[model samples]
Target: MPYARLLTPLLLVCSNVFMTFAWYGHLKYRSVALPKVILISWGIAFFEYLLMVPANRMGSTVYSAPQLKGLQEVITLLVFAGFSTLYLGQALKWNHWAGFGLILVAAWLIFLE
Candidate 1:
């Protein structure tokens, strides 16, 4: 369980990172043909699922299904923000950070006792 505890979040983070790129990186590939972009995105998504499944299973032991789902969503946003900022050269605006803060609050409420 201890290992799973660590592994769950780590795996989720990795999965989110892969998924963020798989989903949004294609926007940068607009110059490329759609078919090729779709194929590459599909390939990246396969790795996302590979990590996501284990993360959910492992996290389920320590967290409720809803909690795990919320965690995944928060991680997804975080990973996407990082990917967009670094790879897409997008800046994080105050409104964006505020929105993320609101999401974190929602996650906290969802997991609250």
Candidate 2:
């Protein structure tokens, strides 16, 4: 359980990397044909699903559904923030930080008994 706690979120972080790429990486290559991008994204999505399903399965062993979801959402936000800035060339603004902070607060609340 101790390891699962750490492992689940780590796996999810990796999964989100693939997910972010699958969803947004195409934006960086608009010159590519739409069908080619779709296929490439699909290939990437396969790996995301592979990691995500196990992350959830292992996470479920120690965390509730809402807890897992909240954790995933927070991780997703952080991952996407980096991905967007680095890969998409869009830095997050103050408002985005504020919104992320609010989501963190909400996630904290969800963890309380």
Candidate 3:
């Protein structure tokens, strides 16, 4: 695989990890206050954008925008799955794996010429 192709997925995964926390982690801080949570989320989101922009640029060389978007979605799910399992201490059931497989198929279809 080309370096851009390899880096695209890694960067997408990193970007999603930052985004998931930025968007969802604020719920844990809701007791503190909404504005404070929003500020923190924005701070984290800055990092998400940093990685996401580069990922899209690197991926674009080998993929159309729609294909890159699909690739990001698949990477996002995989990152979320790992984050949920390892950080959130959640169990991934068969249904979740099936859903991921379906997403993978969607990715394949999107990338297919």
Candidate 4:
């Protein structure tokens, strides 16, 4: 198997962690000024972009554009679920897990040859 197949997801996973923080990690610090928060989020998102761009570039070597996009979405969901539960102390209800499972099934369809 091409290393791109493995490397792309790993980079994407790292990207998503930074993105999750950029997007939602500041909820715990509502008192911070909005400009400061936005600026901080932008800084964090810069790292996300760094990893994401390379992941997509390498992914294109073996995966179609649509496949790469679909895989990214699934990976985003999985990463966000973990981030929300652990870092944010949010409990995932059954429906959330069921919804994620359904999404996974849909994602699996993308890999069919």
The TM-scores of all predictions, comma-separated, are: 0.94, 0.96, 0.86, 0.94
Q: Which stretches of candidate 2 lie over 4 Å from their true place?
A: none
Q: Candidate 1 lDDT, tens digit per residue, 1-113?
A: 87887889899999988888888998876799988988998999999999999899989999999999888879888898888799998989999999999999999898998
Candidate number achieving the greatest lDDT relative to the actual structure = 2
Q: In candidate 3, what are the lDDT values of residues 1-113, reduced to their tens digit?
A: 37997898888888899998987776545587888888988999999999999889888998899999888888888888887777676769999999999999998999888
How well does candidate 4 score on lDDT at residue 33? Answer: 95
**TM-score between model 1 and native:** 0.94
Ranking by TM-score: 2, 1, 4, 3
Q: Candidate 4: which stretches are off by over 4 Å?
A: none
lDDT of candidate 4 over 34-75, digit per residue (tens) = 999999999999999999999999999999887888898899
Candidate 2 residue lDDT tens string, 1-113: 77889999999999999999999999999899999999999999999999999999999999999999999999999999999999999999999999999999999988999
> Could you tell which candidate, 3 or 4, scores higher by TM-score?
4
Candidate 4 lDDT trough over 10 residues, lowest sum:
103-112
Q: Alpha-carbon error at 86 in model 4, in Å? A: 1.0
Ranking by lDDT: 2, 4, 1, 3
